[model samples]
Structure formats: C-alpha cells, structure tokens
Target: SVTGNRVAHTANIDRIAARGATFHRHFTPNQICSPSRATMATGLYPRHHGLWRNGVALDGRLPNLWQALSLAGYATKGVGKLHFQPLLAPVERDMPESLAYWERPGCEDWHGPYFGFDAVDLVMGEANEATRAGHYAAWLKRNHPEVVDLYEPDANPDSRAQDLNEVWKSAVPPELHYTS
Candidate 1:
C-alpha cells in the first residue's frame, strides 16, 4: 500500500515518488513494530539486536544507526515515533528514574549521542494514544496550553493489542493531535 491508489490527503506522495526512485519490492526483517524497528536501527536481525519482542529492552552496547550518524557529525535527529525501548513495565516506587517509559516527562531533554541521535521528537503509540507524551506533547503543552485537552490521554495504560478503530474515531481531532 506504499503506492498504487492515491488518496486526497496523500497526493504529494505520488508527486514526490514520481520525481524520485520507487521501490516495488521491499521487505522488513520482522513483521512486528518494535523488533522490526530494532532491526532497522541496527541493520541487524532482531535476534542479533536481542530485542525479539515488543516489551524487550535493547542493550546499549550494540551499534545503532543513530549512534553512527552522530559519530559522523551529521547532527542526528528523529522527529517522530522512535520506539527504541519498551513502553510498559513494572514500576518500582523506589527508583524514580527507571528507563521503563520512553515518552516520559523529562525525555524531551534527552538529546543523544546515546542512541545516535543528537535531538529527537518521538511519538510511539498508535492513533489516539500517540499523544501520551513526547516532544510533540511537550511542545503542545508549552506553546498551546489551551488546546492540550483535545489530544486525548491514554485512558487504559494496560490496554491490550487489538483493533481500537472506534475508540480512535472518538478521540482527538487531527488539528489538535500532538504526534510529531
């Protein structure tokens, strides 16, 4: 579906692809999001990257594309959902700063040579849940506080993976959505 029929909202895609190279056959190492993304970031299989599932944590020892980009002085930056880590985990009340959360409160300040990116504006969740927290939310909160409520919060923290099309439809307006 990357190409074929064009929608009114994505006419620019056709225009751009017409001006550029097009790929007819491309495939990912894995089918799922997190593992696939891990493979993409490292240019290695999920087994080699050691993050074979959604909730798995990627070890920092491995070389990722962003780290390489940063090392090359490219001013590495990610402007959208970078699901580099797990979303949900058991929270210990003792450790206030566990790495369980990706789009947490202070994560906007974490520009990195750490992951290979010098600056990032990430949003991982799908549809309505994309507004949970990230650079987009932080920017919305800082620049447009009055419209913050329009981007609906994730009501169910433990909501299992399923089609939530109805829920998403009843969620935020596109103009108010804060995902980068």
Candidate 2:
C-alpha cells in the first residue's frame, strides 16, 4: 500500500488519493497483514474476528465489507493478496489460497466466491518469483510459460540482492508482475 505522505514516487496513487481521501494518522489493532485486514473487513478486533495471526482463517460468519456491499446489490471482487485464509494450509483443509490446494486434481476450475468475494483473482504474496500459486500463477503458467523461469529471484545471475534473501530485482518485466 502506498503511504499518503509518500506520494512523490506514487503518482497514480497520488492521483487517486487526490480525488478521494487519504489517512495520515491510522491506528491498527493488529500489526500483521491478515489480522489487520480482518479488523478492517469485519470492524472487529483480532480477538473478536478470530484471525490473530497470518496462518489462520478469518471467521467467514462475521459480517464484512464485501457482505454488506453485496447485500446492497454491489458485486464484490477481490484481486491480489487477500490473506483471509492460510496460504500454506493442508490440502484436506481445502484452503483455496494454499499451494497444497493448487496441486490437487480438480483445483483448476476453482476461481471464486471465497471470503465473501463473488469473484477473486488471488495471489499469495507480493513476490510472485517465490510464492508462485493462485490465479496469478495459473495465468502466468498458461500465458507466459517461457517467462516463468525468469521470475525466479536468482534468475538474474547478476543481481546483487540475491544473497540478502529479502528483496531482489526480478528478471521478469514489471508489466508481467502479479501486482501489475
């Protein structure tokens, strides 16, 4: 997410923020992504929402923004890293976001209606080079199979950031990225 105060590098985000509103003083009950997002979606604290950590699922029974909007006749679609459920759960758990589920026989047709989303195009993590699963992975495999190997962090043999194990400049073009 682009910070409101740091808009210089994010011209597109700045333009969107200019038309609406941007918050500078934001408070979060949970510091982690899943719990914090669950808080925002459910309007409840992490304890109440039942997503205390990253590898847990947010209680689907809880009221959420998507459910509210859907009830009001708005079709809700989620794209990218919506970590409502564990991304590495067991295959038997049937977690749509998990790599285990993606390896299953009939998982190809599964696209949507999860976590109050009428449709979804999900990615597990920000770095598609490493966490290659979900809709983005499928799309990449089907459309850009040749480029798939280039997405690996170490694919760029000249990259200095490879040893850092945190960040790296991917050989894949920016337009091919999941976030793009």
Q: Write the per-residue lDDT of candidate 1 for residues 1-180, one digit (tens) a residue.
A: 246433213445667787898886998788888789789889899889998887677777888888887788788777666666665654542111123443345666765444667766666565555545655656667877766555443433433335233332223445656431
- Local lDDT at 168 for model 2: 59
Task: Please write out the lDDT profile of model 2 over residues 1-180, one tens digit for every residue.
Answer: 256342124546767887999887988898899999998899899999999999998878898988889889999999888888887799888888777888877576777887778888878666643347777888888888887888676887766763437555667877887756
Off by over 4 Å in 1: 1-12, 90-107, 145-180
TM-scores of all predicted structures: 0.68, 0.83
The models' CA-based lDDT, in order, is 0.61, 0.78
Which candidate should be chosen as best, given lDDT against the real structure? 2
Candidate 1 residue-wise lDDT at 122: 66
TM-score of 2: 0.83
Worst 10 residues of 1 by lDDT: 93-102
